[model samples]
Target: MDAMIPLAQFLWLAGALLAAGLATGILAGLFGIGGGAIIVPVLFEVFAAVGVAPELRMHLAVGTSLAIIIPTALRSYAAHRARSAVRADALRRWALPVVLGVVAGTALASVSPDRVLKFAFVAFAALMSGRLLFGRDHWTLGEQLPGRALMSAYGFGVGLSSPLIGISGGGIASVIMTLYRVPIHQAIATSAGLGVLIAIPGALGYVLGGWPHMAELPPLSLGYVSVPGAVLVGSVATLAAPLGARLAHAFTKRQLEVAFGLYLLIVGARFAWQLVA
Candidate 1:
């Protein structure tokens, strides 16, 4: 990929991707997001600048983001685990269903129109922003988490939506945990763990699902996943993840919520603009 790009242009894109990685890592650890909300939009523009077709850019961005999340999510989860913040039991229950969901969603994406994915990204980001920004503590779905069947359903939903939106399942999982009355910090940490589950399979699924389209992708591509995009962003993001986790413990719950909400709002707005324009 670097061989094909002119030195100046390659340097420019590398800097942009590295910068995005820094922010993505921080957001991952700080807010327990997979940072796909950040990566997708940034990569979308990057892919466009690189001459990726309009119809293929979103899928490529999404597939690449999931690949990047693999390492970042693991590092973030480890950092949060050191603080004893993860909900291990919930992760165990969600494991199978979430993987299955990723498989299902990846299959769907292979056949679905690009608009379907772009719309999903916009809608999920908006819904998450609304929940974080305006939701009150009284917004409990129940006193405790639901039964296995319901829990599985939630996990499946997280899995299904995550690949579509290019996230690691953190956004939806954290929201669901909070709705079940889990502490925000714990929910965030657990979501980091859930990200591992979402990212690995999601990335793999995208690669396989996109096999038929390999010829349409940019150079050094593996199916929909861009080798350069993953390496450039994932490497920096992994190193920065621990720092974000440490910072996460320093902020008050409301402060964290507000920051995450505002960030999501900006991302959502950016995509909405793209759709309208």
Candidate 2:
């Protein structure tokens, strides 16, 4: 009983989480993401408001974000796959390497400082933004996806980087596929599947990695992952995801690219400011 939060505060946080979930679901669908980018930032604010310690805040946000992403990623991927947009062959190829990469990333999280994670997030976000905003159709690594060795390498990179940024590997995977001449829609759909791969393992990793810091976290927490956050956010996210997938099909490729690029740019800048400030 002593550990329970005030009912009023809990309600307020619930409202916020639900609102963020709706937005996150929409973006996840539209961008083929697991909504972790949006989730991490929103959870950071929520945790801070509730007095989660500074050192543990980012880890909690990231861990909770991954947990919330599971359902959203599944929903988005299902919606995309139903539309016949997913590149199943590529997904099959990347699956094993991606899982391995996530394992490595999770291990890294156990020893890395929070600042390092934030920096990685900022750097990759900026890279994704720049590629979307400034890259031309002519710019590509090749006209087709490379052989197994290179594809595995790419999958590994996506897995490794996603945990640091609290994403489900959608942004990185989408960008890679597009570079190899996959249609934007196809790439996005395929990337949505990557979220499923990244989130499951990433969430578990965060839980284990943050176990030692449990005393510094809020109540109802599973290590760094917030059970409440996941439940509250995941509920609305799943419902809203289909709508976003529908809307994504309505937009042109350039429009989607521009919108996603702007979104990432803004997010990246905010995190960058946090680092400097």
Candidate 3:
């Protein structure tokens, strides 16, 4: 299409997109954290360069990020499943509530102001980073709560947050599980499985919500999800995810968490700067 010619001319931009995806994919697989921490920021920069409106920029970035995550998570999940690391029971218990929350969150996103959503996302990132960095020692999942309630609460929070922030929901879920004494590896594996569930509905919701606004976007887009961007990013990410999973075995659990925590802090600061600027 005529609209795509300009984008095609910018080969360097395309390379940047792919490289960002590759880095994020490795991080996602290694830490069991969704690539959202990396994806969102990169997307924001890319979209801005392409002249996307400020109001829709973050939403589109988040939506497109979720779109790519669907495939990446599925690929990672498959690999983790093969290793017998996925906690199916936990996934089943939390599925319903999480799905419900995803729908609710996505619907809310469709109508909410962009500024509100961005602020909320920043708050979430800060909270999650704090929990990972300082609260790790005090958290524990007691046997006292019913499985359904625990799953629902955790799933709902993840679902609600994913659409709003364009994250894969793995980081928060893993952190929660770790606090409750779940082995770090199992939590990471299980989070990958749950990420698929979060991404599916959330991605769908974004598409539907952004459909009316599609004509406003640049070429190679489906609503707020940029098809080209997703394709380029998702492809390499899928291949790299398994390698990350394999590397996960090399580090002690504490070291992995600390590394991930530092990553979060860095990412959080970047987003905070974006918000302020």
TM-score of each: 0.84, 0.85, 0.83
**Candidate 1 to truth, TM:** 0.84
lDDT of 3 by residue, 1-277 (tens): 9767666744655776687677767887898665677677677777788677888888888888899889778988999999999778888877888888889989998888777667767777678667756764656767332467766887898889888998878888887777667787888899898888888888888889889888777566778888777887778777777888889999988778778778767766766777788
Better of 1 and 3 by lDDT: 1
Give the per-residue lDDT of model 1 (tens digit) for 100-208: 9988998898788788898898798788889878988787888778989999999999999999988988878887888888887998899999899889988888898
Candidate 2, lDDT over the whole model: 0.83
**How good is model 3 by TM-score?**
0.83
For candidate 2, list the clashing residue pairs, or say none: none
Q: In angstroms, how far off is 9's CA in candidate 2? A: 5.5
Compute the lDDT for candidate 3. Answer: 0.79
| Model 2 agreement with the true structure over 221-252: per-residue lDDT tens digits | 89879888899778887788788999999999
C-alpha RMSD of candidate 3: 3.3
Error of 2 at 229 (Å): 0.8
